[model samples]
Target: MSAKIEVIKNKILSENWFVLRNFTYDLTTKDGTTLRHRREVYDRGNGATILLYNREKNSIILTRQFRIATWVNGNENGMLIEACAGLLDNDSPEECIRKEAIEETGYAVGKVEKLYEMYMSPGGVTELIHFFAAEYDEGLRANAGGGVEDEDIDVIEIPFPQAWAMIKTGQIRDGKTVMLMQHALIEGWLSLT
Candidate 1:
């Protein structure tokens, strides 16, 4: 059974970067109890992410960048390794991921296979990320991708075994990247032999 909810009030808290709104709503429980709740939600629009892998070489491409949020939280250096991802903006999920792959990894990827969509943080953030994967090779190299505007990204291509081990060693800590890597492993797309 799903609970019913109705918005009582919504006010803009901030829009410096994206949008932050304070919402007051009444949530009716299954037992007919209605409770008024107030919450602040951040809406930065939706996004998409992709993992680029080469089956023959058993290697995958990832990016390293400094994330301010992680730094403020606990990460000392805030340097994080993540799959190529970006906001959807006005493009479709597939199109957005394809563009992001090129902008972040320099790979004009071939046929892409969408894996799934997920809400990374549903409690306060309203971002639904579309996940995808594609095979890549040297023939698809478009440019030396390091992000477009203010983004400073470093592209890294590592062997599947080493990359996978980074998860245990706490090197690869991004959620979306970890999920995509695990999916590739389970699907036998990361087999060396």
Candidate 2:
């Protein structure tokens, strides 16, 4: 049984550079078919990646910014501490993160160590996040990291231990960012031991 997507309504709230909106939807289950129904309206989303680069001194690179959408989820106002990442227009996850690293943090990430591929919010929206981590040693620094025009970003550097602690204590609120950091810690990928 093929579960069909029955979209009750998809409205356009605001569409200029990107689109924003309030979408309401309901699903009519297929007879005898186990299909995912659109029971509740969905949140807006786009694809993104998280980059974890460990410099030679056991420090990791992170970014700080003001996230309006994050405040609604539970992140305290202003200051989304996240790894280097950005939207993937159509590029593969690996490619997207590599590019984002250079664009956002001016770091040239080497061969990325795949961490996780998952949806940021499976219950409401389709925001797939691809995560990777690499050593941020020599031959990785590029131009300073920052959004081209509109985004205000401040790079933050912290030792690996502190980063892991924050993830465990919920200080790191970005879903994908947290997942990537935790995976790296447990798997012994970013450890000196």
**Top model number, lDDT:** 1
Off by over 4 Å in 1: none
Prediction 1 global C-alpha lDDT: 0.94
Give one clash count per candidate, in the order shown. 0, 0
Predicted structure 1, TM vs. truth = 0.96
lDDT for each residue of candidate 1 in 78-156, tens digit (9 for 90 to 100):
9999999999999999999889888998999989998999999999999999999999999999999999999999999
What TM-score would every model get versus the actual structure? 0.96, 0.77
In order, what lDDT does every prediction score? 0.94, 0.70
The RMSD of every model to the true structure, in order and in angstroms, is 1.2, 3.6
